[model samples]
Target: MTTALAQRPPATAAYSPPSYGLVDRVAGLRHHSPGRLQLILTTLLTLGLLTGLVAGLTAHSASAGTADLGNRAQPLMVEAETVYSALADADTTAAQAFLAGGLEPAALTQRYDDDLARAGTALTNAARLVPDDSDAARAVAALSTGIARYSALVATARANNRQVLPLGASYLAAASQLNRETLQPKAQALFRLATDEISAGYDAARSSWWLILLLVLSVALGVALFWSQIYLSRTTHRTFNVPLVAATGLFAVLILAVGVLFANQRTHLDSAAQKGSAPVTALAQLRILVLTERADEALTLAAHGSADKEEDFERASGAIYFDDPRLAYAERFTTTLKDRHEAYLTIHGQVRKLDKSGDYDGAVALAIGEQATTTFGDLTTTLDQAIDNRKAAFTDEIGDAGDGLDLLSVLGPLLAIAACVLALLGIRARLEEYR
Candidate 1:
């Protein structure tokens, strides 16, 4: 038995008395071996490399989220603007034709048809984009119905005008109410949606800057660790620790590059929003202004043609339904509309005087030339110019926004993956030396 024990090397020191506790076990383990400086360096370098990788991943994620939201919103905003413009233009053409003496010019008729068709198509596209249950989708659907009904009313009004029946005026009044009540409010809702999304995009863009700071920290930490490892190697007279230095340098480059790329991407997105979306929004507002004026003018004319004051009162009260329920009566239409009405009242009083004097033709001619053509038409052209200016601005901005983001969308991921792979390879090279 003694010979056997000696041959078994005293049973390997009886497993070191099973350690007294966890702390004791840890103490005992440490007593057996001291960590090399190179190992400490490697540990720090590995941590920095992981931190850089995590930062890169986070930046990529944030950028992707921003890109997705902005990209989806862009085309939808375009569709909304197109639908609004088409509806407004159609109303304008119909009103112009009415002022031109019962004669619906072929061109005006065709324009109405085309615009109506375009509006329908646009609404269909919007529905597909917005989903069945969204508020935006509901607003669009309501607007579509209102447009169809208004178009029919306008047609009826034009037909009645051929017979010199005052009922045409009544139809015009109803159509004007539809424009105010259903379509405008719906349009406003869509605008709010677009604006909200745009603001969110700005938030996303701003938030991404945090990634840059993380990158900076990671790079700084990596450099510090790398230098520490070099110092240790020189002091200890070890030639090198391949994994430790390699991981530090690799992570440093990756973190720094990711930060730079993200900064560039954010700048590009900002440029896009400023150039394209902002201008378009302004133009869209101008178009709304013009359309409101046109509808108000049509209502005034129809009120004048009504048989009794009762009809006029009913139409005015009914027009209220078209305005947003949330807004007070005074705020529903433009201030210029009040001015237009004051001017109309003056002309109307003069026409009543002419009627008393048996100068009906003179009154009629004055109504068409001054009230219809000059007052409303000239003012509309001025507003149209404003609309045009805004439209041009929006077009340029949207183009820039799309181009800038799309560039980042393509380059950001590719560069990020490449950086990650390079960092991993550098780390692996050091790890391989451990074998």
Candidate 2:
């Protein structure tokens, strides 16, 4: 037996099993291994990446919204308004020139030419801005063709008038109808489309609720990590981990800064929509009304006692020179316009009476000569002043809105990257201490 035990490697150290207390087993179960630390680091880094991605996306979206509102939408809206105004003014000028007969004044002819040039330029600008297959694009193309046709008609009318032919009146009437019925409505539709796009941009800028929620969750994760660091300090009986603390501070500041920037951007956009776009649009509509009335007045004489033209003039004048309860504060400006317009209607009435009584020379003198000085001329001055005032208001409000959003896109992604770097450094430092 002794020889056998010696041969069995000295009996294997008495054969007693290792002892383990309950506390030791429980501790082993609870303790994190190196692999667990790696897992925790991976999870933290993933969260950091997610947060950064979300921040970058939100920043990009906001930046795009800002650009659309201030750069694309507002400018398009203004251009559309320009087109409408130019077309209306052109029709009115054409009518005024016709009333001057074959010997139209140099100033009146020059004004007509200027209006046509402005309309063409505005149409080209609008076409460049709109998408290729869009309704706005189609409208612009159609208007281009229509303008060519109307010009040809106007030229024919001028030639016939120089030869003392009554057919000039019929040509002028057809061109005016084309402007009133087709071109004006198309321009209005384009304006509406541009305004709709502006509204969409405003909505996009304001709608950041999902981004805000994601940021809140990211902040919560940061707080949890901070608390975990504190727990580790207590359990390990070591000083605080500085890097983790720094990461937490950086994350918090990022959230706060982003929140502030988003809030300010939203405020500025709202102000622009309300104070800038709204007032300018109202004034533009008012300008169209004035141009319509002027066209009606001239068309009445061009039609030579056509009751239809007289009725149209009266209807347009009523809309322009009356208080509209639906328009609210806009009524105040219209009140001033109304006073000037009433004076015009009085002279127009006298001119019509002279035409009906066979006093054709007197009617022509009042309609297009020095007698128009106190009536149509004064009305034109009033409309010009109103347009200038509204334009200034639009410029100031839109400019402020645009300036507020300058730094948001750059700062957002930068801060996100900083937070991610800080988090990785912090976790790596804590892991090194464990190793």
Candidate 3:
């Protein structure tokens, strides 16, 4: 029994771990030159293909986004802003024209019509750009309905005023209320929505994630191709592999060219926002505030003894001079506006004094007189010029941003594919020697 137990193998030795022969053979492959070359070739080809495809898709997507911003998104946003500004001007013109008495001045009448025409054109353009299901479209629809009603009210007010009816003032007030309370709010909403869409588009145009992945894969592929050349040079006593060298040079140039294109696009986008869109929006708001102030001046004379008249004027003045933001491009205009505003305000104070002293007729003349007209008109004209200038700048910058993007989108994939073919040819030459 003792002999039999001693002859038995130990428990650990009785069952040996089974050899996975295929896996062992595969694992041992790294020690051979052919195996090493195969590994390098496979890695380089995989990286090249992945980098190429991802780079192509990312370029296409970014180019599409840039084009959308320039052609569709930004134009829509600017049109909405223009609609907002024109509507406010029309409301102000209608109010002041009412105060100009029975027939109203022909100049003022023409101005009111022009303001409406401008607003209508901008609204039509915005509507064409926005999708029917979007909030911007709904806002446009609301403004269309509201403007018609507001215009009808103003017409009724003018008719009653021609006959010197007391109801004329009430109709005018109703028209102003509809414009300020309803129409302007809807226009502003459309502007906000359009701005949001533009912001999203800018982000889509500069997809950093895709670019980052491309850069990483490109470096890996480049390194593998380079190392394979070194390995061949050492093993085969050859100093250079032409195809591999060419592949490396092609990839390097691709990275540099694309890097520059992306960087330029980013710069143009930033300039568009800073020097164009941002300043344009700020100046538009300022102009609207000025228009509201002018309306208050006219409406106060048309119907006095209101508690909020002077307070509203002061609030608007505060916003224009202190509360409202100013941009670099608008600095000169802002200064001119403030100086002109002070002169207008001085005239306004004199008009108020006469009205309080019971010279209502004289007060009306000074309020709508030549001096008041010139000062206000100058401010409006200058503001319009500034807005136009910024808009032009925006167009130019956006155009530059979108330039060459389409070519790059197509070129990226072709270059990567070419690089891969060269790498394969280079690797096959080494592989043929072993076979």
Q: List the candidates' TM-scores in order.
A: 0.62, 0.80, 0.85
- Top candidate when judged by lDDT against the true structure: 3
What is the lDDT of every predicted structure here? 0.56, 0.70, 0.81
Q: Rank the candidates by lDDT, best first.
A: 3, 2, 1
lDDT of 1 by residue, 54-135 (tens): 5645555555545544555655665676577677667666755565556677776887788788878877777766745777
Give candidate 2's root-mean-square deviation (CA, Å): 11.3
Error of 2 at 134 (Å): 1.0
TM match of model 3 to true structure: 0.85
Tens-digit lDDT track of model 2 for 227-292: 667665764556676766676676676667667766766676666666566666666666677677
lDDT of candidate model 1 versus the reference: 0.56
Ten contiguous residues with the weakest lDDT in model 1: 321-330
**Off by more than 4 A, model 3:** 1-35, 159-168, 322-326
- Residue-level lDDT tens digits of model 3 in 139-185: 98898888889889988988998898968878978998898889988
lDDT of 2: 0.70
**lDDT of model 1 at position 346:** 60
